[model samples]
Target: MPILEDLKEYVERATGLRRPGKRKVSDLARARKPHAVRFKDDGLVPNHPRWPLIIYRGAFEFDERHDPAAVIEDLFEANGWGDTWRDGIYDYVHYHSRIHEVLGIARGKGRVRFGGKKGRIFTLKAGDVAVLPAGTGHQCLSADDDFLVVGAYPPAGTYDECTTIEDRPRALMPIPKVPPPRKDPVYGTSGPLSKLWKKAK
Candidate 1:
């Protein structure tokens, strides 16, 4: 174990793998709250009461991949977020009732309305990432023809499109019970998602 640790340190040093300085909350991650990104409530779909929308701006940029989806897929997988897929946002408003979701905007730009029909709109570009907690409503307001996103969920969680009132009862029960992600999709265990999710009211 000691040899492995020494080797790892040496490799990191040689490869310019600078260690993260500390776990302090970054200003970017503190857009609305310590780790929350509140959206305008559309009055149709109630956002996650405990976990708000999380936006990590420019999380994956300046990369040689030239493809946003590839970078996001790799990032999500590295942080234990699986079941990833590449696609564009839905035109109609919708929400997931069971599992949380992360969307990495890899290409183009678009305005997204979150928190149901009455939600607020935000223009998202490549390199921006939005982490939507379960039950939060979202939809693509408008976008360029090339708009694309890479989305994934934490391990053991699966997504379900829920818009009907009947879905609420079943949705709420699973959200709090949905196990906390082992690590934040961008910052790992020390990131905002780790600090916010599973937090007591």
Candidate 2:
């Protein structure tokens, strides 16, 4: 389908046709930060030695089965911007260095867990934008459907080179054995952990 029609379909599904005309193209761009496209090439050449800073555009494709490992390779090649796939609803562990991720939701909806403590459950119809900062442990929860998200990173490098999540076995923890919370319960705040406990109740 045409991109506008696709976006309209999603808006209709997500907002129940609240105001389709009000949705602007800039809205999507505003939701997600601009993908970084410039880089400083300062270490490889001589006198002109401080290699002249060169900006490169990055690109990648994502689908249901694209491997994270393969995506990393593409990222390095593009100086670190590419699409990534999560086989199913899964958690992306935290990282130390800052990364700017601009994601466009091609399908599905769920919660995004970040900063190891805070999270927001966002229902994406399609063409929705989600921007996340680094040092955040991200994951999709309460997701009943599959999704595709295109992400962009800066300066072109691999997660392995800048992050510790890959080095530690327990870094990217498995999906918690609990659902997201609905309303506050007697036990604790309405959260994933609390929901899990409620399930056991």
- 116-159: candidate 2 lDDT, tens digit per residue: 33333345433444333332334565554455544444333234
Each candidate's lDDT (Cα)? 0.69, 0.32
lDDT of 1 by residue, 1-201 (tens): 335434644554355343321232122132332335665444457677777787777676434422345556656767788887667888887787678889988778999987887667889898788888877899998998878787899875677887777766667667556666788887677777877766635
lDDT of 1 at 106: 73
Candidate 1: clashing residue pairs, number: 1
Q: TM-score of model 1 relative to the true fold?
A: 0.76
The best candidate in terms of lDDT? 1
Can you list the residue pairs that collide in candidate 2? 45-49, 46-49, 79-156, 80-156
- The per-residue C-alpha lDDT of model 2 at residue 75 equals 29
| TM-scores of all candidate predictions against the true structure | 0.76, 0.36
